[model samples]
Target: MILTEEIKRIKSTEKEARKFGIQVGLVFMIITLILFISDKGNSHYFFIVGGVLIILGQLFPQLLIIPNKLWMSLGVVLGYFSSRIILFVLFYFILTPIGIAAKIFGKNFLEKKINIEKKSYWNIRNNHYNKSQTEKQF
Candidate 1:
């Protein structure tokens, strides 16, 4: 019985992640369109809508400024269907790289990027190797 409950929980979590991904993606679309169409003719409306959407998208993954690959894909789809031509082109460029990278590296590309953690200035100055106090004395 516990196993069944665990499976249900896992599935729910996965579903929620996908939902969040989709929502963020939609926001990305709005962001590009808003930025591209800012002008006097109903452009301001698009711009505002787009801005709000982008903000929501960004807030979805708080502190993660760059939306993930899946979000980018959704954004492109949303942007392409948007009423403005300029917005479509802009979003296309923003999202194409995701497909390209995925094609080149498959699903592993998004698993985790190799991030070099920051080391202390002393460590950097001394390189990664630790210095011995006795050696310094000599």
Candidate 2:
């Protein structure tokens, strides 16, 4: 998706980029401050979590640290199941082998079109149009 105008404006200008970072930092500071003003020690834990997320978002360490495309792709897939450890384990134990097999064997599988639903090619100038489906097979 294309960025909205406001985001594009920030992305286009170095000055705006600094301003954006500062404003985002201020937002984090405000949250931390509010947490601190109410209670001190709990907020410090929040600070650690917020800091890690911010740093990761700032520098996407995934592209550097992961090292392998397969492993990176695995991490990206596992990320969806991060919240549920059991599902992640199940996927690791069960579906991973199937996926590997698919990668190895399914590469040579013939492409077949099973579903065909015919519709008009276009709407003509007046009210009706001729319909045809020209299928090209590899």
Q: Each prediction's Cα RMSD?
A: 18.3, 15.1
Q: TM-score of every model?
A: 0.21, 0.27
Give the local distance difference test score of model 2.
Answer: 0.52
Please name the candidate that would achieve the greatest TM-score relative to the true structure. Answer: 2
- Residue-level lDDT of model 2, residues 1-138, one tens digit each, is 222332333222334333434444456767788999987667776566556545543555343232223333455556545747888777998888877897788653443434356364443587554444335333
Show model 1 residue runs off by greater than 4 Å: 1-12, 39-138
Among all windows of 10 consecutive residues in model 2, the one with the lowest summed lDDT is 3-12
Model 1 C-alpha lDDT versus the unseen true structure: 0.52
Superposed by TM-score, candidate 1 places the C-alpha of residue 42 at a distance from the truth, in angstroms, of: 21
